[model samples]
Target: MKTIDPINTTNPNGFKNQASAALEDTNLQTALQRAKSGFIEKRKKAIHLVDDFEHLKTQAQQAKQSALDNLNHHLALFEKNVVASGGAVHRAKTPAELNQIVLKICQQQNAKLVTKGKSMVSEETHLNAFLEKHGISTAETDLGEYIIQLAKEKPSHIIAPAVHKTRQQVAELFKHNHELGERDLEEIRALVDEARAMLRKAFLLADVGITGANLLVADTGSVAIVTNEGNGDLTATLPKTHIVTASIEKVVANMEDAGKILQVLGRSATGQAMSTYTSFFNGPRRTEDLDGPSAFHVVILDNGRSDILNSKYKDMMRCIKCGACLNHCPVYGAVGGHAYGDVYPGPMGSVLTPLMKGIEQATPLPNASTFCGRCEEVCPMSIPLPELLRQLRNDQATKGLAPKLQSMALGIYGWLARKPRLFQLTMGMFGRVVKLFKVSHILPQETPAPDAPDTFVQQWKKSKQGHSENE
Candidate 1:
């Protein structure tokens, strides 16, 4: 209902500033505690259940790479399949064009109340804002999304929109916005009950239901989506018109390919044996179906991806949105999602936001990594996240977008280190300078007291002298 800009909402110390502040907020601590453990533990158990899960990961990653390497080929195959399956396909080369195409559908259908089921593509386009600007009322049916919608904030994490919210906040929000007096289970259930009731009405009366796809099959022209809450199922089935928005690369070759994707997606993302509901819509519903939307539209969005093809950074397109990369990232663990200041966050967000918006707008994002490879290690799609980040860092440094003082300091250090004599002299002087503080005596052994008698060069000299390392 209200507009949330990523740039204005996120704090800028990257994650440390937000996480330390969050540590003190009892409410946020409670909200994040579950998120931190629950996701990892559940996924661990789920991944262990499958045979060949590791091998499957390798296969999936290779498959995604193949798709990205030859995207135009796959996209054409996808378009042909969808048309054959009776769905209309629209290609939007830009966000503004995507918005116009979606609005045209809503206006044509005389849509007044639109119910949504967690489409990130819609978030990418700021569709709610665009639609509301034209007087169309949109409601988010996913519980986390509904909480965020009520709060008038952007999703902190892609998969878990309100991952940053505490139960008390939800309780307070329900009380303030929907009249959940006293916040009892009767009240909480009443709140849940209330959302179900409200959304139920919107579903019945809505002319259009909009959603984002988890995957698209080029072989059958089908829209594949996974959800725990079943809201996606309702939004698609109950409405007269169903509209799906997704980036251009979501297409896979066939149902078998989609299954391989789902295998890793559930395990890596949430650690579930299977998502509660998985739907494959082959062009709305067939005439044989008793209940289904009469018309189905799939909008392919390419706001900025086409140019990334064959570029060093295009591996980003391999993301499946499982949130595994976010879960495993050290920086993401420390700061949480809000700091990156975008629809996506953590490693995946860092790679995606820069690619979509340009490194110029998000120069700080590349440096957000600690060069931690966990995100890439666990990526089911095996995207070279650290490699991409390294490239972006180089891009920023070359462009003078990196902090001048830090860059200059590194340059000086590099020059000195290249010459051993100058390097040793500089190091010895630096050590003596730190020694002057007398504070070095109190410092932990982990840090070599710059003046520590056994510096790297000292060890190197001793090794050349054939002295024992310990001596």
Candidate 2:
């Protein structure tokens, strides 16, 4: 088995360097271009199919908000029900604690092999690396997860973890990893087939399985996960021990609440009415049950989410992990997820990373946005992503974490804004300098600085004069 390296989580400050590198990588650019359009178009079509998608969004938002308002009570109830159903619930206040809890369970089961479904919480905790270090072999069963596992890379997109890999790149990775001689992998179907074939063995041989919950139904203590492939079901049922790693915010009131979110989740995520497999696990298998795990445990990780719940940015907790924000974000589409240098990426990440990590550690992430508002517009839960990002920027300035040059420039602009005439004069002079130096190249490509003969003030004044003369 190939050793998997721990994901680099200490580099939120290095976003600019990573973004620059991402721009220069041809393979990454190719992968990103192919994916961005498909996601956008598919979502458009899926949303069109729904008669009242906005109503569904509102319902989902309300459900999440209600759960959050009564978070402690819901969590307690969830735990109570889990124990009632013969499953155990463990709480971890930190990533290390979560890993330790999972490790203890694996040890208790004497697990030699673990098969995993897609779990962003596990990714945030870096569970695979932690478990592997303790002499356990883990296999990723989700096709995208499996690809990135073989390549030893972090997920570049939330929904499509291996979205940054082109078919050609994936073929190369499979060729280098798989022992099968000269198999056809040029097509997308072939790549998926190869992964399925590889993972089938892992599913049968694994002693334990770990999966993530899209929603944790507090009413019945059920772990709900949706996947395109049926791997999540296999991961949860085939093994003797099943572990679910989830964040505390994932809890919803009941199955009805879960359904409300599920309505928008699938449409907003992959442009389907629902994922191919929407499986819910109540607990371990009963004597009367047909097929399920023998031992079931749910590990809920805080990892700064509790702090977020009390903060002004609590609206972020309402997120359903749909990749709509990422798909619609210009910055994310341009640079891809890896450039953010964190577990989460794109517009949501810009607000989230700084709040979870320190502002000083991820100052660039907040500033990465153009404040286009597309992320907020497309977000199913209506998270004010751009507003949240601006607030983060404000926090950065408050802490003096923003660059000295930026602060000085903003200070000068603030002073000029108080005096209208001086502000116009300064802007006029700035416009001339821009035209003279041909500095439009320094501006964003989408909204380049214009080389117009007159500034807006000059144009307005001339128009007023012309109107006065006509009168």
Best by lDDT: 2
Model 1 poorest 10 in a row by lDDT: 1-10
| Candidate 1 TM-score over all chains jointly | 0.91
After superposing candidate 2, which stretches have Cα over 4 Å from the reference? 1-10, 438-471
Candidate 2 residue lDDT tens string, 1-471? 111122554377888877877787788888899999999999999999999999999999999999999999999999999999999999999999999999999999899999999999999899999999999999999899999999889898888999988899899999999999987887989988888888999999999999999999998999999999999999999999999999999999999999999999999999999999999999999999988999999999998999999999999999989999999999899888888888899988888888887788798998998988999999999999989989998988999998999999999999999998888888888877777777877444654345454668877898999999999
Q: Which candidate has the highest TM-score of all? A: 2
lDDT of 1 by residue, 125-163 (tens): 899989999999899989888888888887878899988
lDDT of each: 0.81, 0.91
TM-score versus the correct structure, for each prediction: 0.91, 0.93
Q: Which pairs of residues collide in candidate 1?
A: 43-271, 184-187
